[model samples]
Target chain A: MAKVLLKGNEAVVRAAIEAGCKYFFGYPITPQNEIPEYFSKELPKIGGAFVQGESEVASINMLYGAAAAGARAMTSSSSPGIALMQEGIGYISKAELPAVIVNMMRGGPGLGGIQPSQSDYHMCVKGGANGDYHNIVLAPGNVQELVDMVQEAFDIADQYGMLVIVLADGLIGQMMEPVELRKPKARPIEPKTWALTGPNGGKPHRIYNLKLQAPDLEQDNIDLFKKYEVIEKNETRYEDYMMDDAEFAFASYGTASRVVRTAVDKLRAEGYKIGLIRPQTLWPFPYEAFKRPNIKKYLDVELSMGQMIDDVAIACGDKNMIEFFGHTGGVLITVDEVCDFAKKIMGGAK
Target chain B: MSRIDRIFCAGFGGQGVMSMGQLLAYAAMLEELEVTWCPSYGPEMRGGEANCSVTISDERIGSPLINNDATVGVFMNGAAYNKFKNKVQPGGKIFMNSDLIEDSNPRTDVTYYKIPVNSIATRLGKIQLANMVMLGALNDQAHLVNQDMLLEAFKKVFGAAKEKYIPINKEALAEGAKAAAEMFK
Candidate 1:
């Protein structure tokens, strides 16, 4: 398809439709509100369903219900709204249901503000709900990447029968850019043999998140962890920009990476061997990408007060020096300021 | 060096700040240049103080934000002018709506064009058309995109239902550009 100017929020819905997402259940929130709004308009035209649930909690449970019925289901929201969906998300993987959730992150611990933020890194990647489970997290840096990732999120969800979350900030959600809505790589469509298409011929399948017995739940957790290991091995993705001989790397993702890329260009022009290590997947964390021995240090940049910095520090380990520069409560950092910060880091680099 | 034009526009909610940024960004995209438009939305927009940043680059745009590196800025109110006056690059240009902003003692390094967008749009009998006038004036001074490409954007935005208003908007744009031609150069 030809390129069309689209907001990051609207692009998510378009990509979901292309990926054969048949049912969307989401409550409204700033920045990401466009996702459900667009879905509500477009999905019905394609003989699909778009339901605005009573609340974010209700919406996610609706998505869970749809996914259990063997339908490609999705729900999208911003910070507080997404936080409300945590229990439902935690419930999905144990039930072995496939669902896609988009959290266009906004500032806060609790309805902070309608500004872009990456503070929910721990919440999304660490499985904020009560469990030993992790959702497959896909972090897209731009609108095109966002489009591709949303489609990929669906495939990854179905392929492994796991929940996949596309983690983008409100900036990425509200920003407008031209994007070609195309599924570049078509993953093999997983057959819905496990779906409960009503007991007409085969044995009935009982699926629920409530694993009451201790050993049964423990075994399920072990199996789920094993599946996560397989996913980590296969689906871990990161992009290294100008990192072949980088002395220092800007470890970031999503909108923060976009600003850092410009800093890389500027700092490179100034003879600073700075590069970018943008993790496309927040989970699986792409620890292998940090094996660049040439990089003397890693500077983790983000819109939050350094949540992802911990992840980068974990990836880099004790050998390399890891520094953090971030803004809290939706205060944005600019390319110029990043360049200034990079210069200071370059001056101090070994 | 790849050209990157970072344009910022600010005003009250209905002052056409968003429209100016959108039109310019759309026109640049039509010209096959990389473009990104980001609005400071939520309370920053709908709560009255609206502002938007548009970046047009020959290369892939890294950040949709301009921050303190705007090559050009358009301000429709005194608050916008005050907030963004020091934000532009040293050699950048600012187009202020003189009719709305009274105290614009612009910085010496960056150039300033005080265009009377409100007065011009008032003359056109469409006060809301200040955004078009401001956009026309800015484009004329900067030559961010050709006149033809911008007209196409106006057409696309106005759509078929409002086809009749295109000519009026085009005239307003031309008038603003003509005003710019007189002031600049």
Candidate 2:
């Protein structure tokens, strides 16, 4: 396929379509409005549903309904909008429905701003609404990876009968880059035997999450965590770069990782043994990457006020070897800043 | 050795700053060079000094940010010029609208070309073509892409606009390129 220029938001829309996603539910939000806008135009042509609900809350529940009926459904929003959808997301997880939710995150504790931000790390990887379930979180750095991850998100969602979240900041949502149309190799999905398609020999097939007894719900939680354990073992993806003999290691994801790569290159070019451990899957967190042999120090890079540092701290488990560098309220951490910080940290200075 | 041209384009909201930077990025993509175009997509873009940063590199781009490392600055208005004039790296180049701004205190370290884009576009019959004229002027001075290749990129980038506007756009590009050659010499 010929490489064509595409904004990241639009590319995710196209990729989801190519992956056989036939339904989209979203509200218009900055930096991510292109996803719904492009899908609204493209999906109807392909005989799919494009519905803009009254708000983000309604939009997410629309996804829940669509996914419950055995349709591949998706919804995208920025930080605050995603926060509104968290209750529905928690419901979807409890119902064991398969859907793809996209968070092209912007700054926020509340309505922060319409710029790129990764401040939703804890909300995404931890609990936002309230639950013990985990969403398969895929953090893609570039437009091409975002394209690929959108396709993979659908597959993973269907495969697990669970929601998969495509995590990108506003930079990936808004930037333009050349991408060739490609779909990941399709995984054989188990038939949705649990879809709400009416009676099976006059017996109602339930897609309900109304476990009344505490023990039953506790058992359900236990079963879900067991599945998550299998996922943690199987789906944990990370990119280990130049870590052969790395003395200084940097851990970042999505946008921050891209900057860290340049900083790593600059440091390596200057005779420093620096490497990067980029967690492509934020939920699975890839704690194994932190268990390296020769890394003396770790730099936790983020677009928030040190949210990912906690994860890095837990991952580096043994030593208090991690230092944090981050920017918040929609400010981006640049390559030069990362370079300077790595040097400062490596110099044994805070 | 390959040179990376990190270009910054800034202007008012309706001045086609994003469009100009995107076209160059598309041109580089067409040439199979690695490129990225990132716009300042916020409230400020709603008429308050809109801008976009572009990077066309021979190697994979790690950070698509020109932040403070822009090698070229193209400003279409005085506000845009003032905001980004100091962002150009030392020994870098700048192209500004001569009709709107006169950088009386221009930097001594880099070359500055005052391109009369609005006047050229006015002469070319459409004032909106100033962005294209500026694009051509930058291409003329930077030699970033060949004229024919840039024309191809224009047709590809604005697929539907080609039939109705390419000829005039071609003229605007040529006039700006010619103007640049005359001025720089």
Candidate 3:
């Protein structure tokens, strides 16, 4: 198929359809309303289901219901909306159901502005609401990556029987770009042994996390962590740019990482030994990318006030070696600011 | 050698500034170049001053926001003109709406052209064609994408509008292109 021009929100819908997402449940929110809008108009045409829930609370629970029934279901929202869905996300995590959730983050500690932001880093990667489980979060830098991540999120969700999140910003949701539409590929079918289908002859199929005993719940936590360990070993993804024998590096992801790319290129042209480590998978966090032998310092750039810096500090294993440059409440950090910081950091004056 | 061209378009709401920039972006997509189009999104965007930034490149676009490095600035009113005149880079170009702007404190650092877009569209008997008129002038000036590709993009975007207005839009485009060519002469 020919490449088509698509805004990030529109691409999410198309990619979800390509990934065989049969049910969508979401509410209207800035920067991501197009997801539900497209699904409402297109899902029915494909004999799928689309429901605009009364609120984000209702929407995420709908995703939980559909996923428990062995259907590929998804939902999307912005920052504040995602906050309302957190408890449901915790439920989905505990239920061990396969689901895809898209969070096109906007500014927020409360009801913030409708612009791009990466402020939900801790909420998305660490825990949103009383969670002992981590959502496999993929941060995509551009529209093409957003498309790829949306499709991949479904497969990963099913693979681990977990929730996967495509953590993009409002900028990626609103910006328009050209993307080659991926051909639909069939997902490997897994038998729905635990699904709530019609019962077999006197067979018990239980799918619940309601262990009354403390030791039993603790064992559940330990088993979940063991699965997470396997994911951490096999699923961590990152991009290394110009890191060979570099003295300094910037660790960033999503939209900020795109700016870091240009800054690294321009600074390298001026003979500055700077590189970038972009972590595409935020939950796995890609600590291996920060283990360069010649690295002397690390600059962290983001759309929030150093939320991702904690991860970078841990990845670098020296909190003092990492410096942060960021703006909060939807103000974007420019490439010039990143490059200037790169110069200052590599000069050993920080 | 391939390069990125950043274009900024500003006008009052309903003047099709976003549509104009998107049309060019779609044309660039048809040309198989890397492109990004971002419009101002805020409470003020509803029937207020509006602007969009478009970047077409051979390499992946780094950022979609327009800083002070626009290669082309298209202003359709005095407010847009006053706001963005100083933002274009040195040796860049400004295509202004002469019908709505009387005087501009011209800068010698960049090329400037005053195209009578509204007048051309009025003469073409459809005021909405003003954006198409300006786009035609931009084509003459920047040569960013082929004229035919733009027309094809227009057909795709203005698909419903074309059933009744394609002929006049075509004429408006040619007339704007002709006027722009005459300016260079």
Candidate 4:
């Protein structure tokens, strides 16, 4: 396969095309504008549909419309834009429509700076639109994974009938990397037999997230939880680097994980035994993957801070070995600083 | 196993920092090395300074970011130099465009090559290709990848351009390599 130098946003667009995504609906926003620009140019060449919606709300709802018609549909936006799309995303989740939404996160509370940030962890995992719906979130550290996960997000969404999110930041969205396009899968397009796709010689199918009856709503919630349980059991993914017989473990994800990996390598070279646990599946949390008997003795949770650390705390549980280190509000933590912390911990442990 | 070498090229926006990094990355892929070229984006790439990190590895690269010190720093302007000079490793090489930067001295510990890259590109009739020229010089001096590999990268990158521009770029590359070779001696 020929390697092409592509920005992360462009890579995602290319990957979506390769994955047989037929429709893209998005509005322009900083840090993720390349995605729509790419689709606008390339989608037509591939005979796909690209639409620039009036707003992020409209774009996500349009995606919901496409997904209801059983097309592989996607949309991308930054933090504020994503906030606007939350209502539609909730509807998609509750309606169980398989769609991919990419949040190339920028710093936020509102119209925050366009720098890369991991501040949207809670909003992505917990704040879909309303009440108890869960969206499977995949965090990619670099460009290749950005492409790979978009494909994976589609597959997972199709398999489980859920909204799949590729949670990335402006940094990952903007960075360029050589990516080999995966061969197109020849799977038949599976239409949702239960969706409201114009009734064909039968009773019309109605699609809505609102269940008026209390008992029915409770049962629906229970069924959703059961599906989430299956995902938690089977789909948690995390990578352990230099973890064998290590006294300290660094936990992080996305762009921060790259920094941790570098720190781990440098510390290993310096004879300081520090391992790294990078959670690939943010929603499933990879709790089981990190719970090995040996690994439990030495795990230090690191994050962009105050956000993902909550997951680490949950995973670590009564096993109080987990500690925290972080740099918040878009402050990047250097490898040297991480290495120093690792050395201090290793020295004390020994 | 495939080996990937990740290189970061940084400097001012118009200095062709991103293009230079991209050329090498595309060239490395042509040589059958797994490659990735990522540019700094957002407001940074607009009118301000720019930089790109290109990873050409034989294996699948785990990350595209350059967290540690860069193996090479090509600073085409004062902002580039001030921003990235300290980011070069102890024994790493720094290529500063002496034509634009009058005082091109970095720390005494590392090897610094002062090339009048802009002047050379001006002589070649197109000052925009200074980034390509610096790339040629770097390949000549460091020999980190290979001359043939870089030329192959140039071909792969510029294949879509008009047929006539290919030879001009190749010549520009050769001129860059010659200039760099002269400085090393």
TM (chain A), candidate 3: 0.96
lDDT of 4 at B117: 82
Candidate No. with top lDDT: 2
**Runs with alpha carbons beyond 4 Å of true place in candidate 1:** A348-350, B44-47
Error (Å) of candidate 2 at residue A339 is 1.4
**Root-mean-square deviation per candidate:** 1.8, 1.7, 1.9, 2.7
TM-score of chain B of each: 0.94, 0.95, 0.94, 0.86
Which 10 consecutive positions of candidate 3 chain A have the poorest summed lDDT? A183-192
Best candidate, TM-score: 2
Clashing pairs in 3: none
Best first by lDDT, ranked: 2, 3, 1, 4
Q: Per-residue lDDT for B34-134 in model 4, tens only? A: 66666766555455878887766776554566655667778888777777777777787888888877654549877888888889889989988788788
Cα deviation at A280, candidate 4, in Å, is: 1.2
In candidate 4 the C-alpha lDDT for residue A346 amounts to: 66
State how far residue A65 of model 3 sits from its true place (Å). 0.7
lDDT (Cα atoms) of all candidates against the true structure: 0.87, 0.88, 0.88, 0.78
Model 2, span A1-350: residue lDDT tens? 99988999999988999899999999998989999999999999999989999999999999999998899889999999999999999999999888998999998889888889998999988869786888989999899999999998998988887889999999999999999878687787899987888886887777776788999999999999998998899899999888887888999999889889989888988888889999999898888889877888888899998887787888878547988899988888988899999998788431
Residue-level lDDT for A327 in candidate 3 = 81
Per-prediction DockQ: 0.77, 0.82, 0.74, 0.51
Pairs of residues clashing in candidate 1: none
Cα shift from native, residue A312, model 4 (Å): 1.8
Task: Return the candidate ranking by DockQ, descending.
Answer: 2, 1, 3, 4
Which candidate's DockQ is highest? 2
